[model samples]
Target: MSFIELVGLHKSYGRHTVLQGIDLQVQRHQVVTLIGASGSGKSTLLRCLNALEPIDAGEIRLDGDVVSGPGVDVNRLRRRVGMVFQSFNLFPHMTVLDNIALGPIRLLGAEPRTARDRARSLLERVNLAHRADYYPDQLSGGQQQRVAIVRTLAMDPDAVLLDEITSALDPELVAEVLNIVRELAADGMTMMLATHEMHFAREVSDLVVFLEQGQLLEQGPPEQVFGDPVEPRTREFLRQIVEAGRL
Candidate 1:
């Protein structure tokens, strides 16, 4: 079985359906990228996987265990699947070390010192150890985003869902945040990301999924999907991306 599976999934906010009959499987250690125009259900898909949004129908499974729908332990599911959003959702009042150490100390039952040490190490990995004493508002967008990623890593999640993590960063700062993700990919971290950075997506993803108006239009390896797409819609999307100098 795949490490992560979504079978016949459906989700809606009232009558406005955001996802429809989506079926996807992600293997362990693979990096999957979801790409398309805005409002293509990419973020919703990731949220469903993390149980941040409950599916209206179908099942989501991780490591052969069902994780979607009611009665599932949302807290437990989240511990295994961490998510980073477009906005750096850091605690403004807390220092970087405290923000990164909170989850491990509170939920994972690690001692305070141990959590702080691990947090510091993660920050060091991302070249943010100097910012450990700084607050979120005191750092640049890139540094804050890096801290957010570090916070997720401190939990040691089985898989991570990144929702347009660089969308909120400035043009020059974008690379700094993306570099962290690239390193994670190299380290074989199982991840699924929603991103508009087409080139980075093509370069790092083992699988690229195209979503359109709540449907899975096409999905394949980067070579096949970006170089030789089967769907006309997929081709047009790439054409637009190219014309816009995004690819």
Candidate 2:
């Protein structure tokens, strides 16, 4: 069985269906990227994977066990499959170190001192250890976003979901955050990312899934999906990205 699997996943917000009968499998330590237009269910899929949003139908499985829908422990699932957001979502008053350690201490029950020590190590890996004492407001957008990513990592999740995490950063700041993801990928972190960064997707992904509207239009190796997409919609989408100089 795949490390992560979704079977017939469906989600709706009122009458608007955000995801439709979606199915995907992610292998252990693989990097998967979801690419699509703004309302194409890319974000919703990631949200559903971590149970941030409820799925109206289908099931999500981790290690062959159902982890989504009712009767599931959402908190337990979340600790295993953590996510980072476009907004960074760092607590305003907490220092960077405290923010990263919060989950380990509060949720995973690691001692506060141990959590902070691990947080400092993660920060050092990302070259942010010196900023550990800085508040969210004190760090640059890039630094804050890196802290958020590290915060997700501190939980030692089985896989990480990233929802357009670089979308909120300034152009120059974008690379800094992306570098962290690249490093994670290099270190064999299993990841699923929804992104507009076509180049980065191609560079890091083991598989690229292109979403159109509420369906997955095409999925394959980056070379095949990006260079010779099987579906017209996928081709068109990449063409627009190319025309916009984004691909």
Candidate 3:
């Protein structure tokens, strides 16, 4: 069975439909990257997966259990499926250690000391342990983003949804944030991220999906999607990205 499944997924905001009959499966331990221009529904899809935006129709399943729809325990579902946004979203007043440990302590009911230990381990993973005592304002954009990622990891989720997590960083800082994602991929973390970093997406993704105007136009392995896109629209999009030196 697929690890993460979206069947006939549909979503909209008022009159603007953001996703239309989207069907995709992410196998366990696989890395999937959603690539598209702005307004292509990439971010919305990630949001829907994490139930940040209620879907208009269809079902979402994780590990063969339907987690969407009414009467579902969204709290439990969220404990298994995590999300990190473009903005770090860390609490300004908290130190980096507190920011990461907060989830485990509050949400998971971990012992205060245990939560701190978990945060420290995660900080070490991202090479940010030295800054664990610093506040969000004391860190660079990249460091804060990494802290946010670790904050999500502190929950020990099964699948992590990343919505343009690197989009807000400076060019030089972008790599630091992406490198943590690279490490997660290497560690076999199941993830689906929306990104414009074509080169990184191609390198990290097990499956690459192309979205155009709220539709899944084409999807396949990185080589096929990037090197030989079959859909005309997909080709045009990639061409423009390449021409813009983004791919």
Candidate 4:
């Protein structure tokens, strides 16, 4: 069975449908990248996976446990899913260490010392150990995002959802954040990333999913999806992004 599965997922905000009948399966330790134009629902899909945005229809299952569906306990299900956003949503008043430790302490009931140690290790993993005592306002954008990632990792989630995590960083700083993610991928972290970085997506992802107008247009290994797209829409989308140097 797939490690993560979304079956016929649909979501809407009032009358506006943001996602429609989306189906995807991500295997263990695989890195899947979601790409699409703005307002294409990529972020919304990731939000649904983490239960930040509830689905209007269909189901999502993680490790065979239903996370989205009738009667599902959303809070309990969220413990297994972690998300990092485009904007680093760290608490302004909290130090980097406290931000990372908060989730493990509150959600997993780890002792304060234990959570602190775990947070420290995660900060080290992201190569931000020196900034552990700094508040979010004092850190660079890349550093803050890295800390956000560590904060999510403290929960030891089954899958990490990255929604354009580097989009807010400066061009030079984007590489640093991507490097951390690359290291995690090398260690076989299970991740789903919604991104505009087509080069990184092509090189690092095991699978690439292309969405347009809230529909899954194509999905396959990177070579097939990006190298020789079978769908005209996919080809056109790739061309536009490539010509604009946004891919």
Best by lDDT: 1
> Per-residue CA lDDT of candidate 4, range 1-247, in tens?
9999999999999999999999999999999999988899999999999888889899999888777767878767667778899999899999999998988888889999999998888888887888889999999998998898888888888778999999899998999999989988998989999999999999899999999888998999999999999889999999999899876
Model 3: colliding residue pairs: none
Candidate 4 local lDDT, residue 242: 88
TM-score of 2: 0.99
The model with the greater lDDT, 1 or 3, is: 1
Where is model 1 more than 4 Å wrong at Cα? none
Evaluated at residue 130, the lDDT of candidate 2 is: 98
**Deviation of model 1 at 201, angstroms:** 0.4
Q: Report the error of model 2 at residue 204, Å.
A: 0.5
TM-score of model 4 relative to the true fold?
A: 0.97
* lDDT for model 3: 0.93
Which residue pairs in model 1 clash with each other? none
TM-score comparison, 1 vs 4, better candidate: 1
RMSD of 3: 0.7
Model 3 misplaced stretches (Cα beyond 4 Å):
none
Against the hidden reference, what TM-scores do the models get?
Answer: 0.99, 0.99, 0.98, 0.97
Worst 10 residues of 1 by lDDT: 68-77
In the order shown, the candidates' Cα RMSDs to the true structure are 0.6, 0.7, 0.7, 1.1
lDDT of each: 0.95, 0.95, 0.93, 0.90
Model 2 residue 114 lDDT score:
97
